[model samples]
Target chain A: MTSATKTLELLSFFSEQHPEIGLSQFCKLTSRDKATTYRHLQSLEIVGFIEKNPLTKKYRMGPAVLPLAQIRERTVPRKSAAKASVEQLADATGETAHVSVLSGTTLYSLVAVESPKHSTRAIVDLKTLPLHATASGICTLAYGPDILTQTAKQNLERFTAKTQTTEQGLDAAIQRVKETGFSHSKGSIEEDIYGLSAPLFDQSGTIAGAVSVASVATRFNADAERTIKHQLILASRQISHNWGGSIPNPIEACWSKTLAET
Target chain B: MTSATKTLELLSFFSEQHPEIGLSQFCKLTSRDKATTYRHLQSLEIVGFIEKNPLTKKYRMGPAVLPLAQIRERTVPRKSAAKASVEQLADATGETAHVSVLSGTTLYSLVAVESPKHSTRAIVDLKTLPLHATASGICTLAYGPDILTQTAKQNLERFTAKTQTTEQGLDAAIQRVKETGFSHSKGSIEEDIYGLSAPLFDQSGTIAGAVSVASVATRFNADAERTIKHQLILASRQISHNWGGSIPNPIEACWSKTLAET
Candidate 1:
């Protein structure tokens, strides 16, 4: 990797749980020499990508991300457009609802909302959903560009026993998503979590992302699944319209047929 | 500059007006060689900092910023904590209200809210507020670290005739802010915008940011300025408490004395 990429990669190590990282901690996280990691941190710090806490002397995300995010939202606006729909989906389904956007071949989680009704619920925590192992990923592969299928097939890392690890397994999953206009994953990324997602579209009239509902597997009965699927379809439609697109006629027809059968 | 800083600098060129740029456009914008710019763009694209529009082939800020913004909000939470207070300030002052955070020697605009009451209200558009020409920047220099004063002195670019372009002028302005626990700038950054700001604090018991009201100069009478100052003090206290800080005893005493005189 280029030094630039390595510097950018260090930013990915930060999250809600681990917001601050010291120089030595960065050394351990990236498995790079201390000098190299410190240099990378310095580069990021100079550009305002990261800042050191005055007390702890640990690095956390800096203010520069805010303007970039503002520009991104003003340009694309997918996250803000999907927010209300995802929140409504979570409220309606009493589960966790999230939206993921497709950039290149990767599925990046845009936003997630967990319902307050349940004590135990699924949390959508992954920054990038693995294409072969998550419902949103499978939905994207089924509906997005053909290049994504090749990308997914190349990195079919097995996460759980239910994760699709082979080309054939992933193809079957994609086919199911294509046929039903929805994707389902049972214990794919984690045990006792069930994910249901429907494809969202943008102004290009092509798949742009997915709106999903994740529920506790133990409570995911047929009625719950039916409710979640219905909510997912509503969320996808609303989000697509907000993004200046609509569910394609074929996907709408598929969803209608699948809902009737369910 | 290192290759990494050069690569990250490309992101700054993107704004609300120029959201997307082609490789040629980037080269022109940065005044760098086309090949070097292309390599920098490639490194950025690899890490999802920028993505090409499928049709336009121009690059814009990508999904990676959303996650980093999320982490920053989760860690520092200054924006969310200050949002309500700024909104209230705008409502009370009938002007544009904004919050700016101090990162190193720079004052970064965290969030801004415009009151719909006026059709020709001031708009806080810039990402970084200049220390010599902005109320927030002057407030930070008056109350934040001494390093900021030196930094502001080094680069006092004049934005308007009223801008403080000399060390003595800036020092005089900062002295007034330090005395009153408030900062005021009249047509400093822009021709007809009047800015009033009060300092905000974080848990570190130091000035973290400032909350300000930007008013159209024509409508900024004595009554309006007094109302804005009163509202700013309220906002500063509320936001400081939300950020796990309080107005220091001396600043509180200064505000009380200043308001009593007003």
Candidate 2:
């Protein structure tokens, strides 16, 4: 890997749970020499990508990311457009709803909203969803660019007993998603989470993302699944339209046939 | 500069007006050699910081920034905490209200809300506020760390006739802000916009940002100034408290005395 990529990789270590990282922690996280990691941290600090906390002397994300994100939002505008639909989907299903955008072989969780109706609800916290283990990821593999399947084949980290760990198993899941016009996963990533997702499109007339509903496994019944699927379709259509794309005719036909049968 | 900083600097070229930049365009923008620029662009693209548009082949920001910004928001919690207070400030004052955070000598505009009450509202569009020319910058100079004043003196870019271009002129403005516990700028950045700002604080027991109101120059009368100042104080206090900081006793005293006299 290039030095620049190595430097950039350090930023990915931060998350909501571990927002701050010290020099020693960075050495342990990257497993690189302490001096090299420190130099990378200094370079990042110089550009305002990271800042040292005054009290702890640990590094946290700086303000520079905000403007870059703002530029990305203005350029793509997927998150803003998908927000209302996702919120409505969450409210209608009483489940956690999220949108995942496909960018350069990565399925990124663009935004997630949780319903207040349930005392305990599923939360989509992963920054990047694994293709073989997520409903959104499986939906993308079924509908998005074909290369994602190859990418998924390379790294099928097993998260739970139900997570597909082999190419054959993953293909089975993808085939099911293609047949149903919706992606469904039960206890895939988490033991008690049931996920349902529908593909979203953008102005490029390609699969741009997926809008999904994640529910507690105990609450997943036929009626709830039906409602969630209906709401997911509504959300996908709304988000796709907002993103300046329409549902492809084949997907629309599949949804019609599947819903008719159900 | 290191290759990493150069690679990151390329991201700053993107803005609302110029969201995409081709390789040659980037070379022109940065005044760098084609090979170096292309290498930097490649590094950025590899990490998904920038992605080439499929049809145009021009580079725009990618999805990686969204997750980084999410981490920053979760870590600092500044934008969400200050958003409501800024909205209330705009509503009460009938002007454009914004919050700018100080980071490494740069005052980054965090968020801005424009009141629909005015047809000709001052729009806070710049990602970074010029230290010598904006109300937020001056407030930071007066009440923030001492190093900011030196940074302001180094780059006194004159935006309009009223902008402080000289060290003496900037010191005079800083003096007034220190006395009144508010910063004011008349036609400094734009021809007919008046700005008033008060400092905000974070949990570190130091000035973290500024909450400012930008109003139409013609409508900025004594009553409007008084009202804006009062609302700005309220906003600053609320935002500071939400950020886990409070107004310093001296600044609070200054505001109370200034308002009582007025």
Candidate 3:
């Protein structure tokens, strides 16, 4: 095979199973001679697709990769889950359901659906939902700054009557999520829309994301809170188990403020 | 920055908005000299990240890139779109939801969710599903032999009462997907579960992947026929639109296949 093909194959070698690899192992995987592998590795390193550990000499994907992957994955788009649980949630509550991620402060939409009878064929545009307003954002805020940092870069935008643009306001919002194990957002992004979000953790003890049940406010009132909360928690656990995401500790996003200065 | 870095910066220039660029214009995008840009382009071209059209002399991402992006964007280990989607779909349906890619006559799962109510999550272990048994795999069968030839490499395996093992059955299955906009398999991949799936197309008019919702016999009965058919059409359309895919004319996939094979 050509050196170019070997270099390209090098990236594929680093996957969720093995995000980092030693030079010798990489050479073995790619079936390239050591010298040839090292030479191309240098080319890849210079190009910012990879970085080498000074200590172990292992290589992992670099920062440059994240932006490209993020944008492409988002624009490229698409969803499903621990299905039985979601079905139960729908059967129990009869509301639209969703799970989402935070990308640069926008609620990067992941997946969602509504009951066919009540389903209005919703269009949850996989665009950014501002952090100050959605249940999904509160979960990210409760975990840490990675979500907020992305949001801050976009400069918080207020879209409706319930919008909160200040840092302090966002902090207060996440605190509520930490205390309740779920967050409730009322029409912050869209008028008359109310959503309850809970954290979905990864195997690594991180908040992988948040799952929320959305309903028009008239239907999600206080009388329905207990049932809704129960379903949301159950759905979150099912998805976390499906994902093998661990429940990470609550975050102190004040660090996010510090990072923002950087 | 180095010449290699500059070359990469040029790539950032290509987005969903702009996918190809000319020589002098490419140099302008990178702010490098004509000669220097030519040399850097040659280095990148030699490595197969980008290609220069011998006719137009313009550059676009090369063949080596497509699969890397596919594996990274689809099969890579990171938390991705399918993960988020399955989680939401599970909560919405109380059934299992999943996403998979065609892999050697089987569908390799990138994501899946378990149902909350089902005492048994028939799909705890996620991996390749037989081509004839799975909703995702049958949907994938809609594509031409170029892709099916790759899938047929698996030789297929029979799982339950309805799994297709022979090449003729598999070919007929592909023909079924072509005749119908959707495909269904009963008690195939797993016993007592009914499966339904639809083709997911990419912007360039290729089958990118498939999404599916599955259920036990009781849950996926006649009432399901209407609900699932409606949601499947909607869900597939949402994802295909995200990939910039339009409703494909069967003949177009045929033309693309002929050109690609030649």
Candidate 4:
């Protein structure tokens, strides 16, 4: 790598897993001499990309990134971050794919994409998804804040007969979603729709939203469901990463187990 | 500067003033050739430090900074960010220096430093500063949210004879602070403490807190006041920059006019 590229790569090392790095740890991580690593670090420090902690004498990310992150958010909003990932998920699944964000306890649709491969695929027409009647809502209740469960219970609007209209049924659905790492709803919100979803997270490491594939019920089979689940995982990972978060290990393990069984 | 340093300097070029830059603008700003500037931009883009707007084709900050900023806040908390600046302010002004943060309508002291220049110095003993009786609280009322005015009027307790006890007196004090860019109080919160404060901002471009230098009443004179104001401006700027903000232009102009008059 070029010297500039190498210096820039040093920033990527300061992540959630490793928030601070001492000079020796930097040297060990990069497999470089202390002098070389220190020089690169100085370059970053001079530009306020890295700061040395006074108490621990370790280097951490500096305050400069806060303003840069603000600018990035203004220039490229969260909706745009998920647009490409949703498009890719729709293309891969040959069905309708969408991303939703939770504000308070309500799940709002951010963006949606539909595949050209399907002549009559599911269409996303709702602005806000009911917390107890959709796959995305179930995924959110399974992973989001505890208060969301109370909110979901209070608004158990029955969109269809299959929708969980009682708190007991909603709790059961949420329990299944927690175990499977994917939420599934058959004819819940819509009579002809089968929705499968995975939770999305943001920098706060909490469940920020969900990514889902809503397919036509008649076209949904065991093979299609397996394919949709795989693509949903990819979409969830991509969207979460784009939003500056990663999938938690437990959810990833659940997906692995569910895929193994599938 | 090394090539790495030069490339990293490119990140500093982005600010609230110039959030986006075209290729020609980058070349002009760095005084480098187009090819060299493009190479540096490419290096930053490869590491996700800079991203080009697909429509405008102008480069702005990337999503990577969000995670880095989050990590920075975790490793080096806001209290730590203000600690060094407050210490420097105390040393420069030879007085007690402190920072107060606004949460909702209440202002709470974050840190305090005593210069040890005198046998007797002002002590910051309060956990929460009264909104109507202290220089730091007045500074917050001047620049913080409008609801703060109502909050201040609701509880105008008289601590000392010079404290602004009436609504009209509080309004006059706030108006003067807005015009002068500094808040001043003589024996308001304490019997013998003279407090002068400047507002501090954060990445939100709003008043997050105030940096104040509290002097002993007997030690306060015109010369000491002038020197304290100068140091207060520096402390405010440093603390605000450390908190990922800059002094607004109008506030900077107000400081300049006040200093020039003094």
Candidate 5:
């Protein structure tokens, strides 16, 4: 990677769980020496991408990101267009529903809502979903850019026993997603969570992202899966239409066949 | 600036008005050569900070910022905490209400709502509010960090005829804000907009940002000014409380005296 790109990459280490990172913690996380890590932090800090907390001296996300996100929404309003559908999906499925946007090879979490019906739920706390370990990632691999398959192959970090850690296993999962028009991952990212995802399209007529329902594994039976898939199709179409694209006929056919056969 | 800082600074050029920017346009805007600008754009694009539009090839903000913004809101929640109050201020005052947060030396626009009560209104379409010109900036200068005054004096970019371009003029305006517990700028940023703002505080017990109402200059008479000032105090208090802060005694006294005298 270029030096600048490497510097920017440090930001990805932050997540809702690890919202603040001290310099030494960052160094350990990135597996880089303290000097290089500190310099990268300095670069990010100067641009207001990160700021040090007064009391803890740890760095958290800075305010500079607000305007960029606002401009991004104003330019292509993805979140506002998808929020209602995701909320409805969550309500219908009685699980956590979310939208992710495919930018380059990564699927960045856009918006997520969790249903209050269940006492136990799957929390979509990840900033970026693993392309091999999550339903959303598999959905993107089935319909997104071709190079994403190669990208997913290069990093097959195992999250659970069910996560595909080999190229052959990953490819088989992706092929299943293509035939079913939905991607399902049972205890891949987390041991007790099941995720079902449908691809979302944008004006460019390409797979722009995925709408996903993450459910508690114990509650995800065949009937629950059917209900989730039905809601996912409706949400995919609603969000895709709002984003100025339509569900392709082949994917529609796959959905019809899969639903009928099941 | 470091090379990474310089590269990341390229993102600041994007706004609601100029969302997409071409490589040549970026070069012209920053007065840099083609090769360096392209490399910087490449760096930003590689990290998904900016992406090229397929049809236009112009670079706009990418999906990467969405996650960062989400993390920031999750950490600080400045927007959600401030949104309803700003909307209420807009509704009560019948003007454009906005909130800005001070990040380092810049006052970044956090959230804004325009009242539908007026056909013609001031649009708060800025990414960063100028510290020497806007009411929000002046309010920050009055009550925020001591160094902000020096920062504002150094830039002194004149946005309109009424903008304080000199240190003396700017200091005088800040003094007015400190004494009255409010900042008022008439046609300072835009020719026909009058902005009145009050400082917002956070858990740190210091000025965190400002909540302001911008109205068309033609409609900003004494009666309207009284209404806006009355609503601004309530809005600022409400937002500050939601942000885990309260109006300081001196500022509250100033507000009481200003309201009582006016």
Candidate 6:
């Protein structure tokens, strides 16, 4: 990799998971010559991104870079929108509801709330996902903007028994998402897991991201598909509207599907 | 001041009150030439400390800077020792309890907790104050490493009506802090507010910081001053012990003062 990319990679070493590292360890981790790592560290230090412990000589992220995390406290983008709509989705279906948005190639949880009666829960980490398998990712791929075409071309790792691996099958699924204005996958990402997702469009007319209510597939069987599909579309429309998203004639789009909700 | 000091002075332009600044306006605010200001911005940006909006060109702090705030979130430096004691301080006083540690000439907040009672709310902001009048600053001034002698010799901004301008008077106050192991002030640095503070040493026997409880003097008068002082010193000692700081019998030092326990 280029020196610039290596420098960026060194910066990534200071993640929330591992906020501090030492000089020798960082050099070993990056597989850099000690001198190269030292140079990058010096450059980073001069600019105030990373700091060394004056007493210990170990490095942690510096005080100069703290404003970013504090602002996330003020603005969790689309989180409020997702919470409002996901509740409605759960009320309609009696299943867990959550909102996950694409971050880099993976998905991140904005926020999540469960149905009042559900006994089991979907476990997840925010902003960590394999792109090809998740319902929210599939929705974005199918009806997502031009970006979906590129993601599908990358390695589609099969994570579970029902993961869609073939490029043609994934394309067909995307086609289905376009037709239905929502996406569904059962046991595709996790065993026995079912998810229904719909895109939340922004004012710029791009599919900003998606909202999904997930549960075990047994709770949402073949007989419940139409009802669940209708709820997903309605909830997505509500969220898009609240976020100042311009979804022109959203109800009319739902009418194009076999749903009577429109 | 040198260019580096001027660059440090640029921080005065940003505060809890006004976090965002336009580049053009920042040039005017800093009184630095456009090229010089641009250079500062470039250095700041390179460190991932700040980011400018591509469209608006307005600069707010960047996301990569959050770990600095995280360090302060531990609330108490030595959690097992300090956390419970500090909470007791807040409960006893019905005011905000704060601990600020020296970061060069400036003080940085390590922990802050609001009072439990809604009526006696706290007005604590993590803004730095000069080491001249504020009780915590005075406590640190009184008991800090010999650096206080060096700092006071150089930069002592006369901040308030209660601010001590003369070196001799300030030295007496510092001598009082070292002797008494606590500091008290009434409407000195800020109007209508009174504060009690005591210094805390770390396990290594270095001046770690000062813990303070502040309240409106109207509720806590000269009669209540004895009680506030009592609580502050006790809490500070307890927290210091928690920090593994064997500060030569701090609790005994509190007993000698007229500050009575309830």
Estimate, for each residue in B75-143, the C-alpha lDDT of model 4 and write its tens digit: 776798999999999999889999999999999999999998999999999999998999999999999
TM-score of each: 0.41, 0.41, 0.35, 0.93, 0.41, 0.36
lDDT for each residue of candidate 5 in A71-139, tens digit (9 for 90 to 100): 776787888768878999999998999999999998999999999999899899999999999999999
The best candidate in terms of lDDT: 4
Q: Report the error of model 6 at residue A166, Å.
A: 1.2
Lowest lDDT 10-residue stretch of candidate 5 chain B: B238-247
TM-score of model 6 vs. true structure: 0.36
List where candidate 1 sits over 4 angstroms from the true fold.
Answer: A79-262, B79-262
Q: Candidate 6: what lDDT?
A: 0.65
- For model 2 the local lDDT of residue A16 reads 71
lDDT digits (tens) for residues B10-123 of candidate 5: 999987789899999999998989999999999998877887876688998876787676677677677866887898999999899999999899999999999999899999
Which ranges of candidate 2 are over 4 A from the true structure?
A: A79-262, B79-262
Chain A TM-scores for all candidates read 0.71, 0.71, 0.59, 0.94, 0.72, 0.64
Chain B, candidate 3: TM? 0.59
List each candidate's DockQ score.
0.22, 0.21, 0.04, 0.62, 0.21, 0.05
**Model 4 regions lying over 4 Å from their true place:** A166-172, A260-262, B15-19
Which docking category, incorrect, acceptable, medium or high, applies to candidate 6? incorrect
Q: Residue-wise lDDT of candidate 4 within A1-262, one digit each (tens)? A: 7899988788878876788889999888889889989999998888778888888899988877888787766666789889988999999999999999998988999999989997999999999999899999999999987899998888778788798898999899999998999999999999999999999998778999999999999999999999999999999998888787889999999999999998
- Whichever of 2 and 4 has more TM-score, that candidate is 4
- For model 5, the superposed segments whose C-alpha errors exceed 4 Å read A79-262, B79-262
Better of 1 and 3 by DockQ: 1
Cα deviation of A160, candidate 1, in Å: 37
Rank by DockQ, descending?
4, 1, 2, 5, 6, 3
TM-score of 4: 0.93
Better of 2 and 6 by DockQ: 2
Docking class of 4: medium
RMSD of each: 20.6, 20.4, 25.9, 2.2, 20.6, 20.3
Query: Per-residue alpha-carbon lDDT of model 2 for B1-262, expressed as tens digits?
Result: 7878888899989876799899999999899999989989988988778877766889888767866776776677788668878999999999999999999899999999999998989999999999889999999999877788997898899898888899999999999999999999999999899999999986556788899999999999999989999999999988886564668899999999989987
